[model samples]
Target: MAGTHGIHVHGDVEGSQVVVGDHNVVINAALGSSVSVRSEGPPPTRRRTRPAGRALPDRAPQLLGRDRELAALERWLGQGYPVQVYGPPGTGKSVLLRRYAADAATSGRDVVYLPAAGVPAEDLVQELFHACYETENYKPEPARVRRLMGSVRALLVIDDFQGSTAELAELMDAAPGCDVLLATAERHTWDEGRALRLEGLQEEPALALFGEELRRPLRDEEYEAARRLVTAVRGHPLTLVQAAADTTFEVDEDARVTGLANGLSDAASVLLRLLDALSPLPLSAKLLPILAGGVDKAAITELTSLALIGSSGTGYRTTGRVAHLVAERTGPARDAAKLAPALTAWAAATTATRHDIAAEAPVVCHVLAAAAHARDHAAVCALARTTAPALARSLRWGAWHQVLDLGAAAARALGSAADEAYFRQEEEVRKRALGVVALATAGGALAAGGVIGHIAGTAGHGGAAAGKTGFAAAASNPAAITAAVAALVVGGVFAGLATAGDGQPRARPTPSGQVTSLAATGTRPPDPISTAPRPLTRPPSPSRTSPRPPTKATAPPSPTLITSSPPTDPGQGPVSCPLAGGTLTLGAPAGGEATDDYAWQAFKECDDERTLTVDKTDPDHAAFGVTPTSCPKTAHPGQYIPASGPCVYTVRFHPPQSAEPGTQYQAHVIMRDDWGRLSMKVSVYGTVSAASTAGPSSTGPVVTGAACVCSPVRMPRRTQRF
Candidate 1:
């Protein structure tokens, strides 16, 4: 029975769950929860959760090609649902979450944005306390945390969450009036809340972002090359940015890979080279130790955090880009040599559990395809046969056939006609036994992931072999169930996670065409990242060990939040800080043909500064485009600017003759610095405060965006993604 504290279990094999809370429950599932373990300690203490990493960035990535996404986020926000923005690494999840948090903060809702790529939950909680109460040392006692959470509305934007989903829900429930919007790169079924999977930017947006990378529009002659380049890399933002510098703009995947891998650390370079052998298939983190060999876990995590590897804790997959770069090396340390044994060892280990053997089934076949290139055909042949049981039980009749076909070819290569005929006959026997496709459609693929294994497990569970050979009995975690790697493989969630033998993203089931998301219950397109199989240093372990379903936090579960805005005068909202450097800012200038010289001190320390110069002032509305005086874009011609600078610039604001008395004119500045770095944008607007009832004067637009509606953080005309 589910109670006030949210400690309940939703047993699928049993009767209905009695949810005695605010959430609506569904039958046969915990629709709102998973296996929850209540804290067994005494009354909560005032123990502070230690904070980690840096605070939220002042700016957000440009929101490129996300109008529909913006509308979806706002609509979901209004309805009060937990929002999940998911996509592969580098799809700009962090940027979106930061924007959401900044907006909420501007609207007077307490906001805490945490970028959790490699951060632990405890560290995040520490960040929460420090951000919320504006105190770093205070221990967050349950009741105290509860008061702040319930007394006011709040939002927690956890970007790239790698912690426990249940734990996250618990923290939210504990904090009564708080809501959460988490972004992740892994794939999971979320039965509740709203899930938005951010894909690669569409064609136009891709080109637009590429131009932005170039900091100029594509030339007419260069347009076709850019188009072919964009299409060649499938509109992946980061790839485009890296490729922009390659003037030749080759229309080849290998060329794009070479370009993207231009500058990488030696450790990263080594890991990528080794991991390339595992391409086209995402290997589970559990197998990292074997695959990565002696590669340090820190390097793996660093790469993961940088999106050069897996999307954090979701296992690792090699991108074709890594393949080309690694291919250039004649390494003394050969990672490819280690590939065969690792696959074989992992395959052998699965035999003990007989669960999700198909997890690595497709991967085995794909690896075999690279036998000649891999310099290890003999082992690959063995690998295919070794995982045969997994292939059949997981309903990979096609893979099973491929395995036999590979074996027959191996025999033929050895000039053994008898062995080849024997292999062919065995293939026919298997085909006859498994018959045609065991299932079709995405849903069927997921279900068939464990069809045969489940049957065997059931037999060992309730039949004559109860508690013996079945997966559940053999599994170390008694309550856990293996999710279908085969199912995902079939539906294209992992279609190109592993590349074909030739080192390119391969559409599985059929090694052709551009990879796409599951048309049904599926995953994202072919976006790959990886690290050596490194040991997990944080919670929210991979789905293999604990496959928790999606659900809302149960009731009365208070944890803690860090920051909130103090009371503000009515109509005088909190002011936002200036947007981060290197983007455009909008200003709605207001005033009549007034030539007012407002002090530009507000933007003194807005961004990284050394020496500032005005690049260009193109007003959306007019010259100095803002309605009134323009926000300062640059300091007086020449001066060294420091981190905290009193960089000042005098600008003439030619407000249109029809300017209004209290209109807020928006000004976008492309602030260029002498340093070899991208320019920063600060949206500055002039504001003439009106009397607040009987008050003398009121707080108005400043260097910040909030009171300024907060620069760069706004829904924005558009943002960059990558």
Candidate 2:
């Protein structure tokens, strides 16, 4: 005989779970679902209850791409470290934990699955206590909980763990011999614990999984389309599933994007909007809050969960296909404008080296391309202008040109004529300077460079990498030289001087190699009186007669007191600087060096002390091999001229570092006086031939080019009162 009574529990609990205590009890329940109670006399054995709704091990769905994670979890459990599975959303952390829980139950371990999204700590402990002790009321203590958990060999699986990490830590610590597995998108909870970070599946597996979802084998052609679909969703399982399910495996790009975004929460939706607005650029995590307009970690986590954003080591970026979708859905609004100043500031403030620039090129290009496409004129222009210097420093002339073109197009779109013209002019100058491509024949090449310069010339400084003639030879063919000169005139390319400032009035070098002072053109001289030299005069001739008898040798006359220019013989036309006549061949099998002692001495004709400089105003300064150590060292080698006043220089020419077997380098030697005046440009040439095999130190014979004559450059005869 049995008496029936009702037992009531006050607090809310899962309807599927039933509590049983330590006593002999006969209860009729379904075969797969039951709670068996035994008497305390049994050797410390406890009753194991399976919730009515819990799926049997065989009935539970299996997870893909989690084999490694499952094995890792088993290893961690054996080693007694509480394991947490963490990653961006849709990475399958929750599914993995659930799978583990079901497996543990099948293995005879007491399994308690708790969804901890919003549950408080004390409540969680009380619930676990009631579930364990089968009592209505009990004061939960960590020690008691630890002892009780050990007896049952309980395994606690917390899903979507969105509670305080401290609470989670407490539970983990108090569980003693019990194993705790947590699944969370947050990283902090796993900081000191063993964590398995879930990422997307590999290509082959992802496609296979997609095929499995479709319940069919993929055709060969479908493999490529499937691969595109998988890549477009970044190999995310949930995204792949949704994408596959929505379009009947057709994978319409827009529909796939919309489907992926269909069920996002408010925070996630906002994040998606922001990411779309900032399309084509990856931003550092530190700038997220500011650039995303006060978006928080939760929002970013939400987006990451959806696999809309990818995490880089330094920052976050929208996935490529997702970024394209975002750009398509959203126009270039305020967010695009906002990205400009932020990125520009970063480029300016950071000491980003060339390597850094190269590394960040993909991200930079993405942002710039989006901006250009959207016609965000202000943003495009600002970024292009700000990053120009760095690009030039890195020798990225191609990228630099693109930046300028972007600015120009943006300016035109905005109908800002002045801005458009400015950018256009800058572009023209860049093209002229760096874009010079000339044939190797010496007489022809110079003429070719001159003609091209005239056609595309602009008054701006040429960059170091500009005007490169990689290989050239001025063969002693007169017809070739004549043809080259004719080509120069016809090609409309003439080596012209770059203007001093941004089209501002300044002293300029004339074709005759004279400096027309800005003062003469109603502007003040660019240099201060302390630095600029007085006008030059032809020094009087030295007496042909013998020097005064050496009774008391008078100190040598001051260089200024000595007459500078001697009477020109009817034979030689005009006198030239000593550097004019020297030849330097770089890459020659035999190395060579040239020194010009007369570089400084030639300026001693003036009465007042003055500075002499090299005429670096020509855009070809770098092409002509004028550097501080070898020639006049100044900031603007083109404009400032080389060699300080009254200084000597030597140029050592050997094969360029790791020179090719048959390469030639050629350029002119140029110098200037301090009055912003230019001396005649001298020609220097070099060629690299094969090395001699007889000895490592021995080099092959020198291959000479056609002889280049240095004609005396005429200077305006002027007398200075200073």
Best by TM-score: 1
**In model 2, which range of ten residues has the least summed lDDT?**
513-522
lDDT of 1 by residue, 1-722 (tens): 22213223342224333221112111122221133423222222232232223445555556777777766666544434456776554456666677766665565555556655434453355445445544321333333344443433456677667544433433443444445678766533221245666656678988998897777889999999888776665666655654554444666656555544554567776776666555534655656666666647776664554344553224665433444354355244444434666777777773433234544454566566666345454665566556654443333344566777776777667666765665565565453222211111122222222222223333222421321234233233322322332322223111211221222222212311122221111011111101101111111212111222322321111112112222233342222222222112222233322232222222322233332333232222253522223334333222222122123333333445455545444444434222222223444344333223221112222222110111111111111111
- As a TM-score, model 2 comes out at 0.31
Over 1-722, each residue of candidate 2 has an lDDT whose tens digit, in order, gives 11112111111112322222222122221211222322321113233453222232222386766677677677545434457776555556666776778777766666766655334454355445545654322232233344454444467777656545445644554544456677666543221235565666767778877887776888897888888776655566766764554434544556656655665666666666666555434565655664566757776775665456755435665654543454344433244544666667666655655435533444454567668877687887777666654443333344556666777788888888877876675565444322221111232233222222211211112211121111112223445545544543222211112222211111221221111221110012222112222222312112112222212121112113212223224342222221112223344353432222222222112111222222233222232334433232333222211123322343333544465655454443434432322332333444555555211212211111111111121121111111
Q: What clash count does candidate 1 reach?
A: 57
**TM-scores of all predicted structures:** 0.35, 0.31
Candidate lDDT scores, in order, read 0.42, 0.43
lDDT of 2: 0.43
TM-score of 1: 0.35
